[model samples]
Target: MSKTLTITDNRTGKQYEIPIEHGAIRAMDLRQIKTNADDFGLKTYDPALMNTANCVSRITDIDGDRGVLLYRGYPIEQLAENSDFLETAYLLLSGELPTTAQLNKWKTNVTLHSMLHENVKKFMEGFRYDAHPMGIFLSTVGALSTFYPDAKDIFDEQSRLTQTVRLIAKVPSIAAYAFRHSQGLPYIPPDNELSFTGNFLNMLFRMAELKYEPNPVLERALDVLFILHADHEQNCSTTAMRTIG
Candidate 1:
């Protein structure tokens, strides 16, 4: 049997029943609360939304009490043990693991788009020598909107996919560029021969005389870290991004 929540107003003894929907996780239906004073005759205050359930999501779930986390219904431990970052990313975005051909296509597209626009490099030059890398990352991402105007029309499925790939592919380059700028090092172009994390490592640490090599153990460790931190339930940045979108 499904559960329902009953809310009663003390002022007029009015009652409202909200149905509960169960998925891989559980969430209470609250779409009925359309307005603050009009619907409930009062406002709820939750500074920073510290204890609020503002929306429902099907992506990931965290059980802090049990120290358990699941991504797309797959346990984090299993994914860390057996899956790579791209596989984990595909699962998070598409709700399923991709077939071999699909994964190859996805990886090819991501690798092909790893290089940023020439104008993006010029934009990096404008940042002050001591500018914080995080600030630069934020501004560079915002600038991506201008570079790809199609991103504005997300209603188009193809445009949305293109922008999504561009973001996933280009962010490592952008972040690496920011770090290089801070250190007064010339930017290192992404290596097509390398995997995603390998390319990022090359861009960040490779030098004119010495090439960077990714260690298998370290690379896998970083992959697990990325997969684990991919998304959590409405942290500060994720909540802000959702609110803005």
Candidate 2:
């Protein structure tokens, strides 16, 4: 027999069988279980989403009971040890790890777009030196939507690709700017020669050095962090971002 949830309305003595999909009953399906035809039936009140699956996603899977997480079907530990952030990001976005040529193209495209517009730099400069870096990052991220009006073309594949690449390439630069601005330091532009994390570190810390070199260990650490946190399905922060933003 096909999977289904047979819900009994004890008050009316009515029973309804709702189709179960992917081992979960849809909340919308419950709307059919009314006290009477005029009644609104049921709504799930899951505070903190303890018993809720907020979305359907193919990217990440979490087995909280077992303390395991997977991104694009790869174990988090495996990805952390074997893949760079950009490679992991490509995997999540494309549903597969990139080939050597594919990764090279991805890296090159991301690097080329690392430089921020002069106006964007000036916007970051307008913030108070003591302003919270998180606040600045959030505000600047919102401001980015205004910078790329074409990103509104949600139906266009190329537009989505463009916006994704732009956001991925530019967010670290803005984050670094936020860090420097909080310290009352001049913002350093992105160094295309550096790796993504390396460029970010350079932007945050390069003072008089002609070439800023990020600690190899820290760079790898950041890459690992990026992989793990890249897509935390149904995390509170993710929920808040979707609700507010």
Candidate 3:
């Protein structure tokens, strides 16, 4: 049988019944408790939001008490141990692990897009040398919207996919340039031959050397860290980004 909650009002000696779903009652169900048509019925009183289910995530899940985290039905620990950042990203986006061909294609596309447009570099250079790196990073990302106005087509799947790849590919470049600008150094172009995190390190730290090879241990460490931190279910920053998105 289905479930419901019964409420008894002492003032009028009246009772009310509210249907329940998923072992919970909707706030709207409480509206039936009013004694009169003019009454506002029951209203929320959660000033501290101590009793709230803020959001329902389709991508990730967290069970704090159990110390468990999963991404697309796979435990996070397994992914961190067995997969890299790009593979985890593919699973998060497509809801499954990729085949060898799929992973190769994804890496190739991301690598090819690692270089930021020359004009974007000029835009970063416009900021004062002393500007905060974080501030420049934020403004640079905002400016990216203008450069890819098609990203505004939120309802279109192809547009979203295109822009997601572009943003993910170019953001490391943007961040590297931001830091380099704060120190008044010429920006280093992305090295596509390197891994995703490796290219970012190259851009951020490469000096006069014509070739930069990222350390194997360091590269894998960064990749694993990226996988671990990738999806924090509906945190403050993700919430704000979701609102903006």
> Candidate 2: deviation at residue 139, Å?
1.3
Residue-level lDDT of model 2, residues 2-113, one tens digit each, is 7988888888898999998887988889888778778887887887667766568898899889999998789999988988999999999999999999999999999998
Better candidate number, 1 or 2, judged by lDDT: 2
Pairs of residues clashing in candidate 1: none
Encode model 3's per-residue lDDT on 172-199: one tens digit a residue: 8999999999988889988878889999
- Each model's lDDT comes to 0.82, 0.88, 0.86
The segments of candidate 3 whose C-alpha lies over 4 angstroms from its true place after superposition are 11-14, 238-245
Each model's TM-score?
Answer: 0.85, 0.92, 0.90
Task: Please give the lDDT score for candidate 3.
Answer: 0.86
Cα misplacement distance, residue 194 of candidate 1 (Å): 0.6
Q: What's the TM for model 3? A: 0.90
For model 2 the TM-score comes to 0.92
Evaluate candidate 1 by giving its C-alpha RMSD to the native, one decimal. Answer: 3.8
* Candidate closer to the true structure by TM-score (higher is better), 1 or 3: 3
Clashing pairs for predicted structure model 2, backbone only? none
Go through the candidates in order and give the clash count of each. 0, 0, 0
Ordered from best to worst TM-score, the candidate numbers read 2, 3, 1
